[model samples]
Target chain A: EDQVTQSPEALRLQEGESSSLNCSYTVSGLRGLFWYRQDPGKGPEFLFTLYSAGEEKEKERLKATLTKKESFLHITAPKPEDSATYLCAVQAYGDVTSYDKVIFGPGTSLSVIP
Target chain B: DAMVIQNPRYQVTQFGKPVTLSCSQTLNHNVMYWYQQKSSQAPKLLFHYYDKDFNNEADTPDNFQSRRPNTSFCFLDIRSPGLGDAAMYLCATSRGRTSHNEQFFGPGTRLTVL
Candidate 1:
């Protein structure tokens, strides 16, 4: 069965602190890994997509790196505005079809205290 | 700006009552998805529409139905609401079937069963 797991369910970090959230997955065939940020009572916003092992993507203070079995979202000098639930999702190649299903992790809740 | 939009940011309905949540997209994407998210949990895919074809998840309940009237509009209809059905309903859209395509999410509708 395809499954995605995120560690450190909740993290409290002081402003300007650097931290990393982990997303581990077990799937048949990894097609892509995605990261999203969701604020309270709102939909998740798309962040980064990692397609292959050793691939990395960055935006401002956030960087995402991928591996064969897992991915990491690293936050650098995170601000209070960066405080949100980070979600990890994986898409797997299924049945040699055009449609691949995405499975999401439970998400990591991060709080940046000022 | 091309984006996904959902109606009724918050919805209150009585148990066993029927309710409908609407979503529209300006991105002209080929696929649309509906997901139900409970508090502190990952969003669970209920169904998706690829152009005019509807695809339902295996675990989705029969009470939950969806309709796509056109390219830009989709609706989620709950025939009978229960307390357990209270959750955030999210709408998302993507360009095509490739795993690399990023999905754009709407603000979501918070459904409250009273």
Candidate 2:
């Protein structure tokens, strides 16, 4: 069975603190990895898509990096506005002829206190 | 700006009653997805529509059904609501049926089953 596990279920940081969230997966074949940020009472917002190892993408103070077995979302100098749940999902190579289903991890809840 | 829209941010339905949640996307994306999210958990994929074709998750309940009447609108119908079925239903859209693309999501509809 394909499974995605995220570590540090919750993280609390003061303003200007930097940290990283981890997501590890066990799947047959990885097609893509995704990162999203969801605020309370709102749907998730797309952050980045990493297709291969050693790839990275950045937006504002967030950076996402991928490796063979895991992906990391690093936040630099996070502010109170950055408080939200960070989700990581993996798209595996499932049945052919159709795109694989995207499976999500439990997510990391981050709180940036000012 | 083009965006995905979900109607009735909060919905209240009685047990054994049927309820419908509506979603519309102005992005004209070829693929739309429905996800169910419980508190503090990752959103789970219930089903998705690629064009007019419907794809359901193997573990999804038969009580849940979906209809995509056109390219822009989709609805989720819960035949008989139960207390366990109360959660937030999210609507998302992608440009196509590709694994590399990021999905855009609406604010979501929170359902309360009494």
Candidate 3:
């Protein structure tokens, strides 16, 4: 069975504090890994997509890196606007029956105290 | 800008009443999806439409149905909403079947079942 897990269900940080969130997954074949940020009362916004091990992407204060079994989203100097739930999803390569299925992990809620 | 758009950011419906959420995209994507999300939980895939083909997840209830009148418009219809169905309904779109395509999501509709 394909499953995705994220650690530290919630995190509180002071303004300018840096932290990292983890997303671990077990799947048949990894096609791509995605990171998204969702604010309260809104849907998720696309952040980064990591296709292979050792792949990384960065935007502003957010950087995402992926490995064979897991992915990490690193945040630096976060602000109140940056505080949101971070979500991760994985799409498997094979299994046509499961195509278009992107399994998501429980998101990490981040609160930046301003 | 090419983006996904969802109408009625907040929806209020009485218990056992029917409701419909609409989504449209200008990105000309071939796939559209609907997901249900509760507080602090992963977004659950309710169903998706690949082109004109409709696909439902195994655990999705029959009360939920969807329509894709054209490539750019999609609708989610709930025959009878329960209190448990009061959550955020998100709409997402992807370019094609390629493994690397990332999905873009709309702002989402917050359904309040009274």
Candidate 3 total steric clashes: 0
By TM-score, the best candidate is 1
Candidate order by decreasing DockQ = 1, 2, 3
Could you give candidate 2's per-residue lDDT for residues B24-106 as a string of tens digits? Answer: 99999999999999999989999999999999988999999999999999999999999999999999999866653578999
TM-score of chain A of each: 0.97, 0.96, 0.95
Clashing pairs in 3: none
Give every collision pair in model 1: none
Residue A28's lDDT within candidate 1 is: 91
Docking class of 3: medium
lDDT by residue (A1-114, candidate 2, tens digit) is 999999899999999999999999999999899999999999999999999999999999999999999999999999999999999989888676666768899999999999
| lDDT of candidates 1 onward, in order | 0.95, 0.94, 0.92
Candidate 3 residue-wise lDDT, A1-114, digit = tens: 989999789999999999999999999888899999988888889999999999999999999999999999999999988889999999876565556458999999999999
**What would the TM-score be for candidate 2 when compared with the true structure?**
0.97
